[model samples]
Target: MEINPAITFQHDRKVMHAKRPKVLIVGAGLGGLTLGAILQKSDIPYEIFERASQVKPLGSCVALNATVAPLMRQLGIYDEFVAMTKVIPSIQIGNENREVEFAMTAYFEEATERFGAESRVISRPALYDLFLKQVPKERLHMSKKVLTTKQGGNGILIRCSDGTEYEGDILVGADGAHSAIRQNLYAELKSQNKLIPSDDAALPFNTISLVGQTRPLTTEEFPFLKKEECQFVRIVGNDKPFAWSTFTTKQQRICYSVVQFLDEESSKLHDSFRNSEWGPEAAGAMCDEVRHFPVISGGDKITTIGDLIDLTPKEYISKVMLEEKVFQTWYGGRTVLMGDACHKLSPAGGAGAGNALQDAVVLANYINALPLHPVVEEIEAAFEAYKTDRIEWCEKAYATSKMLQSVVDKGIKPMLVRFMMKNMPEFMKRRAAEQMYSSRPQVAFLPLDETPASVKPTHQRSLNLRAPVEEEVEAPAKTI
Candidate 1:
């Protein structure tokens, strides 16, 4: 009896399917680790490589949007996340007078009712730890930095800085904004004379952020600041640019970050600030500046108390600052990029992590749906779909973040903006809220058949103006 070709193919696929496809995930950050956990639950074979030798509780707090809550729940770690983080109620925006201007909550109840999930805030390290728990230690590789990647007819190969090589069916570059795999892939595409560099855009606000922890203050003591709330207090008519936020954590720790936009000279001076000696003086100066600002009088005694402590200068060193932009392209072949790796938006709107997490979900879903023995054409097609699906949402987020930065960066002009904001009609405020909170298309890992029509990948839509279908095919896959 002769075995039919299709039957043989089916039998071979069954045997091969028993051994899950090997997925190599670069970077152990939120996006990468989340993808690893989701793949593990799906019983897909995978390995995660991080440049850090060991996991450290690094980075600051992240605010989750309604979209991410479901993904976290799906990973079986949502409760663990909640246990490790705080559920902030609303974000309050005000000025030096301590008067509340605007406040927006996460819409938790509505989010749960509509999306079956609620948003929460988690320290980066805590979330990472939770994700690490779900992944096996053996499958997690550390101190492995991807230097380059090569794709051939058979499989994709990743070359590391340590002179080691790993071959896999697919390579997911979750390495962030400056992704090595993504760079290498683009280099190859350019070598083939097919690379198209997207237009570069400048950040609307050039801001610096100083983040640190402070002694807890009661709601009554610091009436201007709310416990478990993100309060944005802007001080108008201040000599120097100043804005501060009070972010409460699950541990009842109040984490605060002060942001200011410096002009050319001040920007350089800030960069050259000395940690050993200058930091103390700078912190003291910053405190003095805050105390003298007109807004300090708006709150009770405890609220003004933050203006007294001369927090060690070294504490100022913990601040994370960035000058960001929305890049033109997010993909370049068998090795595509996601998250901050594509567009590094300002953190004003608290949507950076949310957008990045959504990118990972969408990309992972597209790749998992391909045939086990995928052709280069099929891989390219999937990447094209991912890029097309995400551009607009990313752009909108990029724009919104910049606008928020502009409002905060206001030096002498804040008074004018405030006047307009205060005088704006209720109808106008509602319209703005609708735009701000409107749900964009989310990329999920559901089977194509189960994906809702509204949730369909952005690439499939004819409405994409920024990232058209024809433009997506311009760049061909290449080895770095």
Candidate 2:
């Protein structure tokens, strides 16, 4: 299909407005920002409402693979994104004694060659900034916490805490795990007896993590920072229920996180923390506890987790509960949810952020295909098709996250899982990496990426819907 830029003439504002549905996206997180970026590229009208007054650098780092690289290129930010990231050549797993139990080195080269994109790590703020630059400041509304939402005969309306109301054809809940939109949608569904019993249950998790990035350090302090590839090291505790990891970034800084595996007793101890707001204050107590843990930073000079914590600015440190659940209810009426709001994954596997960005691509594609004046039924169908296209991949990512979590978990089963990983064949590891990188979906309404890769990407149904009108009418088989 030959794609043309969406027209927006000063004199034809009415015609431009009638070409696509107006989108109201809640939560200016990774998913929402990405969707807004894609919508902007497609010239679809969108407004983003974020509850936070300002962007806070909470999390440590995100490992983005080939899965979302093409989309980044489509958004015109791939080169800048690559410039800020450090390619992770290999991951070395060690014991509490600082002994290397096993190192995963075989698949990095093969995966890069097969996928045409390297698995790279960038600090959370860098990633946030990369996407933030794509969105226009006027379209972004901070401190606009959505108080409530209602669907009327005309469209959907969201009333913010600031007492301002905005109406749009579609409402997207891109907020985090405890999304307000999901809560409201679920409440409405439950009242109608359409909510799934499993979806109503609380998100379940057994791990808590303290993540932060250290200020730039000299090579004299950490020699590994000079390497071309990232120095990714993960170490398990001796008898303690903790594991610590460090990744050297491109900006001469070390991004680190400590994971705590909780049992029934310890889980209750962290009840208050789990229920607290998502930010840095909650990470204070846990920071002191893990400071004494050792880190393998690749040199004779030993460093403790506390050292890195002390080096990190207080605002950048955060304690996060790694909740792992794939919620069944994704949308209802004109309201829909994406990213962590729908499927919260443990960060151990480094798939959460990547999946969120990919969710934006698939969801935005379907939204772009929506009629200018879509009815409730048409909106629901688009949402259903988006869910159908993404849910399976989300489940696969969730499974992969759980498997990686098991390796760092404190139990006999986790040990066995680690043992299997330690002894797994190189070809099998490469095969697994290929499976993970196979779903590289691009922006459908925009020009498709021609980046070459050895592994065939999974077919995107949304791509077929973006054909020229004449060709589309001739075939007529691309309906969602």
Candidate 3:
């Protein structure tokens, strides 16, 4: 079947441009790599710098919401995603023994069907692989950690850990929460006396995450476990911290985490996490407590639960901080920031990846427009337009994630939570499901008029023709 030419044009315009703008992308994680893939389709001279020596499968699972589907499709990796991951038709709130409290399958299905998109659960490493494959190997520079970035009249210069310097028309910091570029920007502002003397660092939320894979279990043995569902088994009322288990794969691959809210007293202890390790002894004790409840251990399947898996205790989770005013000044001269660097959203709504991917898409459109016009003002305008269009969506997602986390960490009893779950009206359950599954923001791009002429229709077609002519010219001088 023939693909639409317009779609092809939009996807390949970057490769056809005469002179692409130099784009420096920091970090090679999902957000950074996604941006790289989008830039690959356009005529954008770009490089990706990753701190790690090699890309590793870091996280367990990621929830790909409906909003991310279009971006994935645009990147030409949507089909591969579908094939590699499982579509979570619904989210189920259950207990330790697997007693369903509130089920939301129908609501999720309806929303997806209506929106022409589906939510998928995939291993983070798998998704990263997809993005990495789309980006050219030569363009990805691993083990090059960005130390600092300086913006001058001409362009931006990035200094790396190895003393190498990279000059580019635009620098994008797709780095995560601890962004070096962000810190540099703040330092610049501080030195100019534009900000206060007080420490601007955010207070760390006291929480710990323990992640591990479990042996496969039969559905019959684990009666409450659904085949394709992402189960959020909340254990409330325990003296310990709030805990939950998520099933990301059909083969019983599980991700279980417990979050403890540290009190003032507990926070004072510097080695509190080391002191309270959820090691084999702790896991055994917890298993014993859970085994008593059929719902948690799945009764007969209790034997299959792996021995206390790797424990990541007492790691400080960063709280979401919104720089509502600072976002207005995101584009400083030739350097810009995207993804978490531009807007750091809490992971509660699973919108970070989606939002970051959208940033990449919009930025690519803007950069592709540069070669045609080659105007500094136009480039800056494009960056402003990107921020204008995306700031609200990012802010909202961050706020929503924070709100949901607050509710889950309220210290309600497991029995009471389960009771509430069991008694929740079908309609209410559906509404909540819709809220979680349907909250994805629509993907929007900067107006085409805002796009530089280079990526615009006239210039795109011209560049496409020039390619054929150049090939012909090179082909000529053949022995005739």
Candidate 4:
């Protein structure tokens, strides 16, 4: 399991010089943007490079759990975060035939009492825009597709597609699941004969997803969509092609994600997702496979995937293969990976983006703790510490999200899942949720700093962890 302790750091020892470390982050997605926000607050100099031509919102919605609220607050965006989100307190699940399977309530209400922060959901664009508000326009470079990196005598040079070059003390890969930076890092390790064959293995896809947002649903059309702002809905089938979750909000349009489990028939389609052009034709073809499946909103109303597809803008409908992957290697020398670059998960618990934001905050903390004008050696050490603090939690979240996704696949196991989940006592449910909800990661050195953002409360009152008498120290990293 030890990965490239085999990949040696090729520092230009003779050319090394001292300078205040500046971070160059690749990808302006949640992880990259959030890291920029934190570094800005700490007065750390950094630049973010995005391949996209503009900062316009591109994706759908994202979920926010108790784990990320403290970091948002510290970045001074908590009120803006709260203002645009809606809290979903319960979940309702059913079969593809519209038969009720199981329903869980008070999970969020209880989670709130347990975590002191609310479990909420918001549009991805709003979050991206909000995070960008703090990032200066000059700091964000657009359409700068990363070409490669070279370690010169003084520092690392990042070459972009337009023949432009940028130099930085450290490079962070936040380029997401298909990360170009991640590929380059591994490519270097591979060139050194240090990367295992599996290091560049393909991500597995057991489910095909079509997610989009629709115009707001009328109460008469779907009561469930409005329940506590948005009823977190999940639907599966015993013998059908698809399963789904209606994600959030009555005030805004209904955001939904319908997943078609891979089967003998659909597996034929899965292979071509990477090559296939996504548009109305693709979405229509996907809907044709599961148009007969029923999505129940309440006791009286039921709709089909075809119905929802008709409501969605063709441009917004995403036909993607849901994947779960945890890379064995996350860093090399002054370059390191963050968020989806290292661990890409199924959007099962709606926790993928939240975990990415957590990675940004934790990584920033480690880097910021270094003495003024830290060396590449110090930056590399901080990267190791960052991975140590995050990898176990990332793996745990990965497994949990996979299980949640499994429940929505078209299989008989969902029947057993319904039985087990429904039979559990609410207190047991609360305790289980408390265990999951309480896992908020923090900067070990933050409490010792004399900054306004440093002393911000964690919004984690339920764990009842005894206040440590002295500064927290690093222990052996947890093994997954």
Give the whole-model CA lDDT for all candidates, comma-separated: 0.60, 0.86, 0.56, 0.71
lDDT of 3 by residue, 262-322 (tens): 5656556523333332233334433433333222544444522223232222121111121
For candidate 3, the C-alpha RMSD (Å) to the true structure equals: 10.4
Candidate 1 has its poorest 10 consecutive residues by lDDT at: 462-471
Of 2 and 4, the candidate ahead on lDDT is: 2
Question: Candidate 3 or 4, higher TM-score?
Answer: 4
What's the CA error at residue 53 for candidate 2, in Å? 0.7
- TM-score, model 1 to reference: 0.74
For residue 266, give model 1's deviation from the true position in Å: 4.6
Which pairs of residues have clashing backbones in candidate 1?
A: 96-295, 176-341, 177-341, 389-458, 389-459
Most accurate candidate by TM-score: 2
Q: Which residue pairs overlap in candidate 2's backbone?
A: none
RMSD of each: 9.5, 6.8, 10.4, 8.5
lDDT of 1 by residue, 15-134 (tens): 342333468888887778777876776645789898777765434467786556656666656677777766555556666666767654424324444444445676555666777788
The segments of candidate 2 whose C-alpha lies over 4 angstroms from its true place after superposition are: 1-19, 467-480
TM-scores of the candidates in the order shown: 0.74, 0.93, 0.72, 0.84
Cα deviation at 176, candidate 4, in Å, is 0.8
Off by over 4 Å in 4: 1-18, 55-58, 264-268, 275-282, 299-302, 443-480
lDDT of 4: 0.71
What is the clash tally of candidate 1? Answer: 5
For residues 239-358, could you state the per-residue lDDT of candidate 4 as single tens digits? 666677776663466677778777666676567775443344466666677666677766476677667767766666767667678888888877899998999888886778988988
- The TM-score, computed over Cα atoms with residue i paired to residue i, of candidate 4 is 0.84
